[model samples]
Target: MAHDSRTPSVPPVRTQKLRAAVSSRLWPIPVFAVAAAVALGVVLPALDQAYDERFPEVLQVYLFSGGASAARSVLEAISGSLITVTSLTFSLTVVTLQLASSQFSPRLLRTFTSDRFVHWTLALFLGTFSYSLTVLRSVRSGTDGGTEFVPDIAVTVAFLLAIASVIGLVLFLAHLTREIRVETMMRNVHTETAATIERVLARKPSPDTDAAAAAGSLSGPEALAAPDGQPVEAATSGFLTLIDEPGLAAVARDAGAVVRINACMGDSVIAGVPFATVWAGAGRFTAAELEDLSRRIGGTVTVGFERTNDQDPAFGFRQLADVGARALSPGTNDPTTAVHVIGHLSSLLCDLVERDLGDRTVQDSDGSVRAVLAGPGFGHFLSTAVSQIRHYGMQDVQVALRLLALFEEVSWCDRSGAQRHVLQAGLAELREGIGQHHYTSAEKQTLMERYQRAQAAVTAQRGRPIY
Candidate 1:
C-alpha cells in the first residue's frame, strides 16, 4: 500500500532467462564464430586471387608458398583434424556434464554449462573447421583447366587457426579438469552469486528519481497483497524466470492500475493460473482494457523450464544449499567440503541481513504506485541457505560448529535486528537438530553455549552497527 514515487526507467530489452540460455546451453556464440570465420574464409581467398601470386616482397615471407596441391592438402588436413577435435571436445563436455551431475548436484550443470572457457573452446574448434573447409574450396589446380592457384594468405590464416585450435584443446582439457573439482565449482558458484547480489541490491538509486527508483531496485520482487483485484492469468506452465518490472510499471501507469505480482521469482505457474492481480486506479477497467492489460502483463513475465539468477537471489542460495547438502550426504561424506560451503553461505546470508531488502514498488509520474513486486526476506534467504545443510549435517560436529559460526557472523552484520527472529528460529532448529543426534552431553553443552552466546550477541548487537 506504500506508494514509492520515482522517475521513468527502462526495463531490460532481453530477459535474463534468454541470456542464461545463450550462455549455458552453448551454440549461440559458436554459431557466431562460425559465421565470422566463414566470412573471413571467403574474403581472404578473393584477396589471394587479387594478388595472383604476385605479392609485395614485404608480404612474401608471410604468405604460404605451397603449390595448389600442397595448399589443398593443407586445407584438407586442417579441416579433417579440426572436425575430429570438435567432436572430441563435445564428447568431453558431455562427460563433464555427467560427472558434474553425478558427483555434485544436478543443479551444478548450470555452472558448467555457463562456463565461457568451454564456450570459446567450442567456438574456436568449430570456427577453425568451418574456415578451413571454406578456404579449401577456393584452392585451384592447373590440371583442372585452371591456372594453378593457391590462396596464399587464406591458407596461411588456416594454418594459424589450426595452431590456435591445438592450443585451445590443451587449454580446454586443463580448464575442464579444474572446473570439475568440487572446490573450484563451489568457488565459481560463490563468485557468481556474489556478483548477482551486488547487481540486484547494491546499485545506488538516482536521487533525481523517486523513492523506489533505484538502478537495480527494479530488478526484483516485493509482493504486496491484492485483496480486491482481477486475476492476470499466465499463458503457459513453467517456472517464473524473469520479469520486466519497469515495463510492467509502465503498463500499469498507462492503464491507471496497480499491478500486484502474485507469484515470486522462481514460482511455478500453470497455464491459466493467475500469476498476478490488477486493481483499477479509479473504478475499474473496461473489459477491453483489462484484456489488453492481461496480454501485456503476461508478455512481460517470462516463464522458463527452470529458475535463473537473473532476478531471483534465492536461486543462488538454492544452488549453494544443494552443494552443501550433497557434500554432507553419506555417499559423499565430505564434511570438510560442507564446512567450506557453509562459510560461503554465511557470507551470502550476511549480505542479505545487512541489506535493506523488501518489496520493490514502481511509481508513476503522478506519484501513484503503479507496480508492486514481492521479494524474499531474510527468513527465506536463511532457510534457503541452511535448512538442508542443517538437516544433513545434524550428526557432524564439524558442520554443526561451522553452522554456529555462520549464525555468529550473520548476527554481527544484522545490527538492525530486523532478522533477529529468523536467526533465533534457525538457532532453535540447530539446537533441536543437535539433540536429535547422539551428541554427547559435552558436545551438547558446547553447542548450546555457542547458541546462547549467539543469542546474547544478537540481543546486544541490536540497534548497533558492528563497524
Candidate 2:
C-alpha cells in the first residue's frame, strides 16, 4: 500500500501569527470607536441643523430651555452609567480570566484575550461614552437670550447606546459564564483542532500521485550535498511554527540551490543555530546574495514565544494533553474531565490515523528538489496526545482503561505498519504500567481484559500475537 503522506493546508506560520497579532491588538477596536465617534461628531451637528431647518418649531421644543446645563446632566448620567458598566465589564473579564487560568490551562488565556466579541462589547460601551462626551462639549446655551443649542438627536442616540450596553452586559455575563465551563472549553479546543486537521491534512492523494511522490522521495537526500553548500543560521530565537515550502522552493529555484531545513515545526531554536543548509551548484553566493537568501528563508518560517495551533497540529494536541494532565493532577483530581479530554484526543488521533503525516518536499517546475520541510509524523502526534496523560493519569483505572480502549480503537483504522506498531507498543506499555502499579485485583482484571482485547485486535490486524 502507498504511504498516506501529504502536507497540511495551513498558511505559513509567520503569516498566521501576523494575522493573529493584527487581530488581537486592542487598537483595532479603538480605531473603530474613534472613527464612529468622529463620524457622529461631524454628522450629528449637520443632522441637528437639518432638523432645525425642516421643523424649526419641533427643534425649538426639543432643545432644552436650560441648554448646555440640561444637556450636561443627561451626558453626565450617560457617561457615568457607561463608566460603571465599563468598570463592571473589566472586573468581570478579569475574574473570568483568573478563573480560566486557575481552572484551565494558562495558554487558553489567549483564546479569551483575542475574543472579538469581548473586544467589540467593550468598544461599544467605551465608544458610546466618548461619543456622549464629545456631543456634550458641543452643547451651548444662548448668550444674551439668543436660541439655546442642544444636540438632542445625539444625546438620544447616546441613551440608546447605553441601553444597548446594559443589554450587552447581560449577554456578556451569560457568555462569559458559559465560556468558563469545562465542557465548553473542551468543545472549543476540539473544534479548533479538528478544523486545523481538516484544513491541514484534508487532501487524499490519488494512486498515481502517491506513486509519483514515492518516486520523488527517493531523489531528495541525494540532492542535499551539492558543491559549495553552506549552512545558514537563524537570525532570531523562538519556536519554529511554520515552513513555507512553496515559497522556499521558489527562492531555491531562483537561486539554483537545494535547501534542507534542519528545524521542524513546533521546535525551539536559538539565534545563530543552523536553521537550514543550502547547496548552491557550481558557484559561491556573494555576501549580499547570502543575506537576501537568509532573509527570504526567514520569511518562510515563523518563530514565536508560544506554539500556535494555526499550522502546528502537535501544538493543539499538546494543549489538549496539558488540559487532561492538569485535570488529573492531585490538586485538581478531576478524572472525569481528563476522560472527556482523552475521548476527544482519541477522536483526533483516529482522524490523524487516516490522514497523511509526512515531510513536505517542494520541487521546482524542472522537477528539482528545492526545499524539504520536516513535519510531525503519526508517531509523534500519537505520543504527544497520550503519553503525558498516560504518565500522569496512570494511577486512575478509568484513565488507564480509556487509554487502552483508545489504542484498540485506532488499531481498527486502516493504518500503516508503523502506525500499528506504535499502537501495539503503546498497549504493551500500558499493560506493563498497570502490572507495576498497585491496582486492586478487580481493577487489574478489568484493565487486563481491556488490554487483551486491544492486543487481540492488533494481533489479528498484524496476523501475529502482539504479546
Candidate 3:
C-alpha cells in the first residue's frame, strides 16, 4: 500500500502490548523473588560481619547459643511452612479457575489470572523461602571451644518474613472466596465496560462547520478514487483488537493522503485481506516506500486470537450477556442469576444511551479529517446484551417478564430519540417472541401487561406513541 506521509508518530501496537505485558501480574512473582534473594544475600552477610568485627560485646550475650544447628533448624522450619502455604495457594487458584470457567464464562479466567493479590501473595511466600535458604548457607560454626557464629540478625529477619507470609495466606483465602462470587464478577465487568466507553468516546470531536466540511470532502469521489494508493493486506489472522487513531491520522496528515479502515474493532480478519486502504495524495512514492508505510500502518493495528476488554467494550457486554444465557440454559436453569445479569445490563445500557457512537473520525490540528475508524453503535451493544437472552429464555415466563422490566426501566431513563427507538424495538421483539411461543393465556397476559408498561414509559418520554 502507498505510504501516507501524513501518518503521525504513534508507537506500534506491538510496543504497547509489550509495555502492558511487562507490567502484568505475571512478572511480579519472579521479579520479587530475585530481589528478595539478592537483598538478603548481601545485607545479611554485611550485618553478620559488622556484629562480629565491631563492638556489641553486650549483644553477643543475646546471640543464639546453639551455633549452626539452631540456624539450620529455623531455616528448615521456614522453608517447610512456606512450601506448604505455596502449595495451598496454587491449589486454591486452580480450583477457582475451574469454578469460574464452569459457573461463568471461560473468558473470566483472564481476570483471575491477572489478579494482583494472587501474584503478590505467591511472590511473598516464595521470596521468603528463598531468603531463608540463602541465609542458611551463610551460618558458620566455629571449632570446639571457639566462638560460635550464628548470623542472629539474618535469622530474626527470616522469622519476621515467615510471620508476614502466614498473614498473607489468611488474606488470600478470604479474597479468593469473595472473588468467585457472581455479584463480584458482574460488578467488575460493569466497571471495566464503563471505563472503556469513557476512554474511547472521550476523543469524539465536537460538531464544527469546518470538520463537517472536511468530512464531506473526504467522502467525495475524488478522494475515494485512490489510483495511486495500494491495498495493505493484513499480516496475520486474528480479531482486530485495537487501532492507534492519532498515529494513523498523523501518518495520513504527513503523507498527504487519506486512510480508510476496512475492519472494525472486534472483527476477525484473515491474512492477505485488505484491512485498510491508503491513497497517496499529491506526493508520489516508490514501491519500497509504500511497503515501509504498510508495515508502519500494520504496526498501529493489533490482531489477536481472542478479543480483549482493553479497547473493545463489546467484549464486556458479550461476557455479561453470556453469563445470563448460560444461567438460563437447560442444564443450569438458574433464572435468578440471569435476572441479576439483566439488571447489570440495564445499567450499562442506560449509560451508553447518553453517549455518542459511530465512525470515529480523527481530525488534524487544522480541523481536516485525516482518518475514519469503525466502532460499535449503541444498537449493536443493545442487541449483544439482550438478543441472546431474549432468544434462549423466551419460553420461561419469569425470564420474559424480567426482560420486559429491564426494557421498561431503561426506557424511563433520559435518552436520545434514537436510543428510545432501539429500546422500543427490543420491546416489540420480546412481545412478538412471547406471542409466537406457547404460553398460557394468563401468562401471556401478564407478559403483555409488562410490555405495555414499557411501551407507556417510552411514549411518555417522547410525548407520542412509539409503536
Candidate 4:
C-alpha cells in the first residue's frame, strides 16, 4: 500500500545504506591522499638526483635534504616565493591603474620598461620577505644561524622601473593640460566676435555690458528737428563715427566673421570696394555686435547681416543714404521718391571726394613725386556755389562740401586759358547730366549759379592750365 506524505520519513533500509557508504570510504580516502603526496614528494627528489647525475651541467638543481638546517631551508624558500609573488602583484596593479587613468598609449608605456622588469622587481621584494621568514624558521628550529638573503639585483631593477613609469605618466598629463588651454582661449575669442556682430546689427549696443567691461565709449544721443520745435528721435546720417577709436588693428581683430580695412584717414575708402583679408578670430558675432565695435572704433564702418556673408545693409555707405532719406521733409510731392532722389544725390556728392582721393596713387619704389589723378569735384565747388545746399540736407554735408572746396582753392593749378575753357566745358557737361530730370527746383537753380562762377574763374585764370 502507498501513502501520500508532505514530509519525508526515514526508512530502515535507507538509513542502513547511508551508514554503510560513510563507514566504507571516509577514513581511507584521507589516508590514501596523504600517502600519495608523500610518495610523489620522495620519488620526485630521487628522480631529480638521478637526472642531475646523468646530465649534471644541463640540470638546474635545488636541494633540501634532511639535516639540522633542512627545516629552516624549507621555510626560507616558501617565504621568499611568497614575497616575490606579492611584490610582483602589487607593482603590476599600480602600473596598470596609472596607465589606464593617465591615458598613456602602449608604445609610451614601452618607453618605460618591459613587463619582465616588473616581474623581476616583484620577485626581489618577495625574495627578501622569504629570506626573513627562512631566518626566523632557522632560529626556531635551531638549524643554522638566523640569516636573511634578498637579491640586490632584483630590488634595484624594480625601483628603476617604478620611477620611469611615474615620469612618463606626468609628461602625458602635462601635454593634455596645455592642449586644453589653447582650445579654451580660441573658443573665447570666437564667442566674443559673434556677440559683437549680433549687437551691431540690432543697433543695440549694451551700455550695461560695456559698463561692466572696460572698452570704448557709447555714441552720444542723436538730435533731429521735431514738429514740437524740440529734438526728437532721428537717424544719424553720414559716416557715423566710431567712438574711442581702437585703431585699425582692433577693428580687424574684433570685427566678427569677416573684417576688411577700407578707408584710412588719407586714403579714400569707397563704399563697395573690398580691402584687406578677413579671417576667423574673435567670436563670430552677428551684424549688430560688429556695429557696436564699429561705433566704438569710430569711422565709416558697415556691419554685415547675420548668417549672410555679403556686406550688411546698414553698412557705412548704405547707412548714410538711409539717414539722409529719413531727414527728408516732404512738400506736395512723393515723399518716398523725393527721399530716394535726395539720398542718391547726397551719396554721389559725398562719393566725389572719396572717389577722387581713392584714385590717387603714388608711383614707384623710390617714393618720387609721381601721382595718379582720378575723378573730379571737390565739395568746395558744390558747397560755396549754392548747388549742394539745394540738392542735399544737413549742415554737416554743407560744411564738408565747403572744406573740400577750400582745399581745392588753396592748391596750385597750372593751366592755360584755352585749357581752362576746355575743363570748364567738361564741368558744364557733367553738372547738366547730374542735375537733369531728377533734381529739385532748388538744386537746379544752385547748379546754374555754380556754372556761371566756374566760367568766370576760368576766364580769370586764363594763363594757367586747368589740371
All models: lDDT? 0.80, 0.77, 0.76, 0.33
Model 3, span 199-274: residue lDDT tens: 5554323458436555554642345455665677898999998887777877777777667787878889998888
Top-scoring candidate (lDDT) = 1
Ranking by TM-score: 1, 2, 3, 4
Residue 187 lDDT in candidate 2? 85
Please, what are the lDDT tens digits per residue for candidate 1 over residues 1-467? 22343222323648455677698878899999999999999999998788755877888888789898899899999999999999999999999999988877888888888889999999999999999999988888889686877888999999999999999999999998898888898888888887777666543244465343553344333223435578888889998878777678888867767788878888888998788889875666788888899999988888888877777777888888888888888898998888988988999887777554656666655445678777667788888888999988879887888898788888888766778888888888887887788888888888877777766765665623222
Candidate 2 worst ten-residue window by lDDT: 1-10
State which candidate has the highest TM-score: 1
TM-score list, all predictions = 0.90, 0.88, 0.85, 0.19
* Candidate 1: segments with Cα more than 4 A from true spot: 1-11, 15-18, 52-54, 202-227, 285-289, 462-467
How displaced is residue 296 in candidate 2, in Å? 3.3
Off by over 4 Å in 3: 1-19, 22-27, 51-66, 143-147, 203-230, 282-290, 462-467
Question: lDDT tens string, model 2, 1-467?
Answer: 11124654566546776777856564578568867976796688668756755757755665444466877898899888887988898898888889888887887776677777788888888888888878887777777587777777777777777788889889898898888898888888888788878877745577788897778666543546555577788989999866666777878877877787877677888898887888775577788888889888887777888777677677778878888989998999999999999888888887887776766677665455677776777888888888889888989999998998788777766344447777777777778788778889999889888888888876665323354
Candidate 2 collision pairs:
8-200, 9-200
Over 4 Å off in model 2, which ranges? 1-18, 55-68, 143-146, 214-222, 225-229, 283-292, 415-418, 462-467
User: Looking at candidate 1, what is the lDDT of residue 190?
Assistant: 85
